[model samples]
Target: MNTVEWSDALLLDYEPMDTVHREFVDLLAAAQNASDAALPQTWAAVVAHTVRHFGHEDEWMQRTGFASADNHIMQHRVVLNLLREGLAMAQAGQMDPVREMAGELAAWFAKHTQTLDAALALHMRREPPPVATVHRPRGGRGAHASPG
Candidate 1:
């Protein structure tokens, strides 16, 4: 089973944002190591969650008028498309692709969170905290966390 652990280093200095990101990591680990019995649904949820998480981040960046928003959105699109293809494979009963995809995503996100995401987080931290309410909205990749 894939194991996911969280540390303060992953924190982007924004509590709500970090919470979602940590959950994303946890899902990545869980989806990677999950048994065949849980593979299909779990894989779908991971894909969905990632898409939504990207959306959330994009919305935040747009609202804040972050200069790097375009680059960030492009990265998100590419990753999500890759994930969607992986999910499609999993749904077609090819589990191996899921393993490979999950590993790649984990590595990518780890480096991404530590760098780009962290930079954005640090910038947000310097600004006054916004009054944004975060809730899991409908039509997203379904995954569960103990709420960060």
Candidate 2:
């Protein structure tokens, strides 16, 4: 069996994030099942995707002023750092460490998605987007300047 499998519990109802999460699960499973020769590359792919994954979420949190942004971002940073370390370990011919980490990562991902990401997705769905009111020309005959 794979270390991680995609299920409804993993779905956040945020399509963008759900899609990324699916990719993460698949890549992690691939890493977990990879042979010695393919392990490093599989792990590397997971690391690369996670960098982008966390980055996009962090950016969204910042942009939307998510209430728990700081703590959520901290968790992402710490986890991503550990993942990067695992990638290095994989590259160094130490396969067992990263293999173990893959399992740990799956557990972490489950909780992280259920709590932090779910909250973020709910916040995103509930919160109104940033204000960018369209401006009409004065009297319909002059230039309009939009607020920054």
Q: lDDT score of model 1? A: 0.80
Task: Supply the TM-score for candidate 2.
Answer: 0.85
Pick out the ten consecutive residues of candidate 2 with the lowest summed lDDT: 137-146
- Any runs in candidate 2 off by more than 4 Å, and if so which? 129-148
Candidate 1, 83-136: lDDT as tens digits: 888878887889987787787777788788987788778767776767877676
**In order, what is each prediction's RMSD in angstroms?**
10.7, 5.1
lDDT of 1 at 106: 75
**lDDT score for residue 7 of model 2:** 94
lDDT scores of the candidates, listed in order: 0.80, 0.91
Model 1 RMSD in angstroms: 10.7
Clash number by candidate, in order:
2, 0
